[model samples]
Target chain A: MTSLLNALPGAVSQGLIWGIMAIGVYITFRVLDIADLTVDGSLATGGATCIMLIRAGLNPWVALLIAFAVGMIAGFVTGILHTKCGIPAILAGILTQLSLYSINLRIMESKANQPVSVDKYPLLVSSRHVGGFTLKNPIFLMIIIAIVLITVLYWFFGTEKGCSIRATGANSNMARAQGINTNSNKILGLMLSNGLVAVSGALLAQYQGSADVNMGRGAIVIGLAAVIIGEVIFGKIFKQFWLTLLAVVIGAVIYYVVLQLVLMMGLNTNDLKMLTAVIVAIFLAIPFWKNKIAGKRLGKKEASKDA
Target chain B: MLELINVNKTFNVGTANEKKALDNLSLTLNDEDFVTVIGGNGAGKSTMLNAIAGTFRIDSGSIILDGMNITSLPEHKRAAFLGRVFQDPQMGTAPSMMIEENMALAARRGQRRGLSWGISEAERTQYYELLKSFDLGLEDRMTTKVGILSGGQRQALTLLMATIKKPKFLLLDEHTAALDPKTAAKVLALSEEIVTREKLTTLMITHNMKDAIRYGNRLVMMDEGRIVLDISGEAKKKLTVAELLAKFSEASGHDETSDKMLLS
Candidate 1:
């Protein structure tokens, strides 16, 4: 119990970082209605880019920005493959993800892992400060970033271009009929989503003091888990857009907290991935199951009325 | 004004299911010409509209709209000058969007959408008045999602959206076919009111002969991807469903008539 309490802050910090990636996933999965798998690659791309740039004596902030731009380029490639080349969105993301693996390795100078120690570099956030109550703590910075990101996204989604993108996702036929270039809007959405995921990756690398090529493996599943968890828990309470985004971030925090508790209870770390998958699958199935049960009740009511 | 010269389109060119959807079809519409189109299944009525809207590239054709050649323009590009409502009530507006947001989208159809706010306070007032004019109490539910609306309400909203920003041409592809009879009549009346008020040129496809004759200034009949009958003014005003059936049979040299068309 003492160990679990001691590990709480670090898990929360990690959760906050992954929460940012979950926001990216929400944009593509919920808003654009596309299950974009490019985050698995772009997240590592961001980590690799940020750590490598920082190692080469660049400002950490600027490295993060460049990482975001690179991730957008990755998303742009996937968008083109889907829109221009007529590839299915999932397949397009997979292709970009496959290519990004090679690209991420190249960025790390053919190394599978690279480290940028907090002592040697001016990192933005670090796990070393996780337990601290100061501004230097990753928790403080992550909360601030989450607030700013959600606010900006809330505003952007209420704008003309943003509404058009929403329309494109909701009904492409209606969007095209209303003179919205759905293909361009789709490309823009993918770029924005992947860009956010990259920023999250950059932060994660800074927090962990290392960048690994496999740091972002199965990231889409994690993102989906966070999104579904958020929706299931706070979807009713967070009716507003910004609140929903905040819920996703909180959802990640909850996820990590729960995972910490499970680990303290003697769960093997090797079984962690499978547990996450199962939890996500169950959460996802809840809505479908609810609908089926409701339909059966309605059917029974109509039958009773006939009798 | 709009013109389609020698438009041709064929689907599945090399397969056993190969069918010519459009074949050397040509059409012309003058300013404010409210034309009604009628035909049996496979008569290429909807295909003609799709061709005009640039849903797909034509095999051989020139489509001129307001002195601009738009034959090669894509659907979204062509949408700048065209307003369209489909047969399905769900096709014309984004179901997940608010009613006011859908109206805003329609209001900016031909304009470039930038970083500006999607809906303005002033625009909200205007949309409120527009929705009020529908007399469907939609004014009270401006923030409601369109998905919650009934089929009749959605169809009415679609009509309003299509004409919110006056297009050079309006296309209604059996837009009221999916509604209940009373609701269908209400939507049809709303459509006529909008068309008349806007003085917009339109091509409305209908399975109902009465609606085709009673609504538009001109009537056109198609068969096998070709226009078989064109009537206007006193002649069309005097024409009955029986006369139209006779005319269709004579023009196509077939006694086969769609029972649905007759029944409707």
Candidate 2:
């Protein structure tokens, strides 16, 4: 219990950082209704791009901007594959993710891992500043970033163009009938989502003090876990768009807090992926199960009333 | 106001399932003409509507709307001039959106969609007034999602959306076929009232013979992807279901065996 309590702050920090990535996932998975796998690679791409740019003696903020641009390019490829070439979205994302593997390695200069020491370079957020009350603390920085992102997204989705995108996600047939260019909106959504994912990767690289080729492995799963967790716990109350995004961030925090407890219970680190898959699978099925039960109850009530 | 010249569309072009959905079909609508379309299954009535709406590119033909060649225009591009309602109640509006938001989207049809707010306070009042005109009590549920609405309410809303922007032409592909008979009648009456009030050009397809006979300034009967019979004004007003059946048999040179059109 003491050990878990001691690690709580660290868990919260990691959760907040990853929460940004989950919000990106929410854009594709919930908003655009696409299960994009590009995050698995673009996240590492962001990390690699940022780390390499800093290694080349560039401003950290500038490196982050470049990382975002590169991630958008990756998303553009997937969008073209899906819209222009008529490939299925899932397959398009997989192709981009596979190609980004080589790109990430090249960005890492053929190295499997690269480190950016906090002492050598000034970073936006770092684990070294985890317990501090200063501005460099990852928790505070991530919260601010999350709030900014939610605000921007809320305002954007309320705009005419953003509503068109939402309409595209809701029903493409209706979107076209309403004169919305659904294909273009879909591509735009993918770009925006991947850009944010990359930004999250940049933050994660800084926090972990390294950019590893494998850092983003199974990242999409974690994102889905966070989004699902958020919706399951807070979806009932948070019906508004911005509130839902906040809920997803909070869901990430809860997920990490639970994960830390599980780790403290002497679980092997190597089995973490399997556990994550199990958790996400169960959460995904919960809504379906609830609906089925509710439907049966309704049917029984009607039958009894008729009798 | 709209012209479809010899439009041809074939589904599954060379496969065993190949079917010529539209076969050199040509149609023209004058200003403010309300034309009711009637056809049996596979007569290409919906296909003709789709061809005009640019749901798919025609194999060989030109569609001219207000002197603009729109045969090559994509579906969304052509939507600027067209208002469409589908047979499915759920197809014409986004179910997850609020009632007013759906109305706002329709109000901006064919206009440039920039960063402007999706739904404004003024638009809300206008939408409430428009929805109130339907008399379905939808004005009070402006913020409610369309998914919770009944079929009748959705169809009514769809009708409103189709004409909110005052499109060049309205295409309704059996829009009320999915509703209960009473609701269908209500929707049909509302459609008639709106069409008359707006003085808009319209092409409505229906499986119901009574509706085909009772409404519209003109009637078009399609058979085997072509217009076999066209009646207008006094001729359409005096036509009966049995006489129409007789005309159909005479036009097609065969005894009508299928009850699909006549039964409805």
Candidate 2: pairs in clash: none
TM-score of chain B of 2: 0.97
> Model 1, range A1-307, lDDT digits (tens) per residue?
7888899999999999999999999999999999999999999999999999999999999999999999999999999999999999999999999999999999999999999999999999999998877889998889998998999999999999999999999999999999999999999999999999999999999999999999999999899988988998999889887888888988888898999999989999999999999998898898899999999999999999999
Clashes within 3 Å, all models in order:
0, 0
Candidate 1: list runs displaced more than 4 Å: A296-307, B257-263
* Chain A TM-score of candidate 1 vs. true chain A: 0.97
The window of 10 residues in a row where model 1 chain B has the poorest summed lDDT is B255-264
Q: Which stretches of candidate 2 lie over 4 Å from their true place?
A: A293-307, B260-263
Task: Work out candidate 1's RMSD over C-alphas.
Answer: 1.5
Error of 2 at A298 (Å): 5.8
Candidate 2 C-alpha lDDT tens digits along A1-307: 7888778888998898889889889989998899999999999999999998887888999998999899899888888899899999999999999999999999999998999999999888888988777777778878888899999999999999999999999889999998999889989999998988898898899889999998889999999999998998888899999999999889889989999999888899999999999999998898899999999999999999999
Q: In model 2, how large is the Cα lDDT of residue A146?
A: 87
